[model samples]
Target: MPPPHSLLQLIWLASPALPVGGFSYSEGIEAAVEWTGLDSEANAAEWLSDQLHLSFARGDLALAAQAITAWRAGDAQRIRTLNDWVLHTRESAEFLLQTEQMGRSFVEWLKLHHADTAEVFAGLPATYPVAFAFAASRTGASVHDGCLAFAFGWAENMVAAAVKAVPLGQSAGQRILARLANEIPAAVDRAMQLTDDERQAFAPLLAVLSARHETQYSRLFRS
Candidate 1:
């Protein structure tokens, strides 16, 4: 088990109000809604679930898990490699912007709490997962638990996006959150089990929609 204070820190890191501008991005969900007509409650829930498993779990979640280990070990080379991978694999402009902007924001927030943060990421273009891993490493949580926090944070943000883009009621949002909550542990398990070579970022549909969202006539979220 994690120490009590560490557990609390993890919860805090997972909060939507952490001020990393996460609430401003729907991570392609807005595009999915507009382009694919993902309007109904069931469709929204299913969309998020598939995203949780197919795209997020395999990509950022696994990367963050690896990055947590690297940060704890002070492996600067590994960290840089991971960060570069995230930057290069971004499928669209919006996707790239979302990761880079949130990463910069998260690092800035961390500097307020941990003075060394700015120095640590000085010359690197940290992606969101990599920056988040640095914060999570300080919490002394196991990689699995750190990933749980990460995934839940993502789930909350995406569900919020679905609520706004789908125009669903609060109850529907809660239901989607509940479903994601139940599935997060399993996704984290898979993520934690991934080897460095196995991590990948391949969500073609999400990429296409995100590109479309860049030019979307009306928008509620950044990506």
Candidate 2:
């Protein structure tokens, strides 16, 4: 088990109340709702579930796992490589902005508690996952627990987005959140099992939707 203080830190990091601007972006979920009419409770749950298993698990989750290892080892080069992958692999301008904006915000938040964070990430364009990994590395939690925290943070943010975009009630949102909670461990397992060679960020449909979302007629979320 992780240390008590570390566990608390993880919970804090996972909280939606963190000032990371995670609530502003729906990660193309709003666009999915607009373009694909993904409005029902069942469809939203399935959509988010598929995204968790397909796109997120294969991409950012895996990247964060590797990045946590790199941060722990003080491997600046590996961290750079991972950050570069995030920058280049973003499917759309909004997606790119979401990661970069949230990453910068998270770093600034870290600076309030950890003085050296600014210097440590001085020259690097740290993406969300990489910056988050750095914070996780500072905790006494194991890599697995850190990743769980990261994934749950993401799931909470996405579910909130779904609640608004799908127009679901609180109870429906809780059901979706419960479903995602059950699936997170398995998703994390797959993310951790991936090799650098096997890591990928290829979700063509999501990319297309995100691109279309940039010009979406009406929208509530940023991406």
Candidate 3:
């Protein structure tokens, strides 16, 4: 199949090579693995699939869909509102740091490589989801397509984290990612259908895990 005009850019935005420091965050997965004995490929896959469906696909990606639409329509106040929601809903300091830093990093990436577009964000807080929405609005993909890219990027980074944290093999990590890929499209579809009121960062155990990770005796990932 031929790439769309912005497919390559979509792919780039989703790439682990984007220098957003996404490499440093496990989003509580590391701590969960340590505390919960998520030591096998199957265990890792199950945990991630649950996270995809329960948290990310519903919450972050939904906001991304809204933010993307707002950005495309040049709605600055809507963007700020979404950004504030992300900040206020963070369940832990580590989680908050993870999103904010990645957001700032993504924004800086936009500024360096796509200045004209980044200029729209000069005065806005670009939390990861919102910054992602801002950058993804330029992709020209349907919102679902853009959400798919976001989901895959998240799965890839997360699989890498599982490999290191769970100490799984490369093949095990690949298997976990494969399972996540199978679930992502449906998750993205569900995300696309959500209203702003339904979006929430409401994972209780995940929050506890993330807070514990902040002072974890020894840790590889930041959150």
Give the per-residue lDDT of model 3 (tens digit) for 1-223: 2257678878888898889999889988889887998888888889999999999987898898888899889888888999999999999999899889999988888887676855677777679989888788887787777788888999999999999998899998888888888899899889988898788889999999999998899999989
Would you estimate the TM-scores of all the predictions? 0.98, 0.98, 0.96
> TM-score of predicted model 3?
0.96
* Candidate 1 to truth, TM: 0.98
For every candidate in turn, the CA RMSD to the true structure comes to 0.8, 0.7, 1.4
Ten consecutive residues with minimal summed lDDT in candidate 2? 28-37
- Candidate 2 on 61-88: residue-level lDDT in tens? 9999999999999999999999999999
- Angstrom error of the Cα, residue 23, model 1: value is 0.8
Write out the backbone clash pairs for model 3: 28-223
Residue 127, candidate 1: alpha-carbon lDDT: 91
Q: Which residue runs of candidate 3 sit more than 4 Å off their true CA positions?
A: 1-3
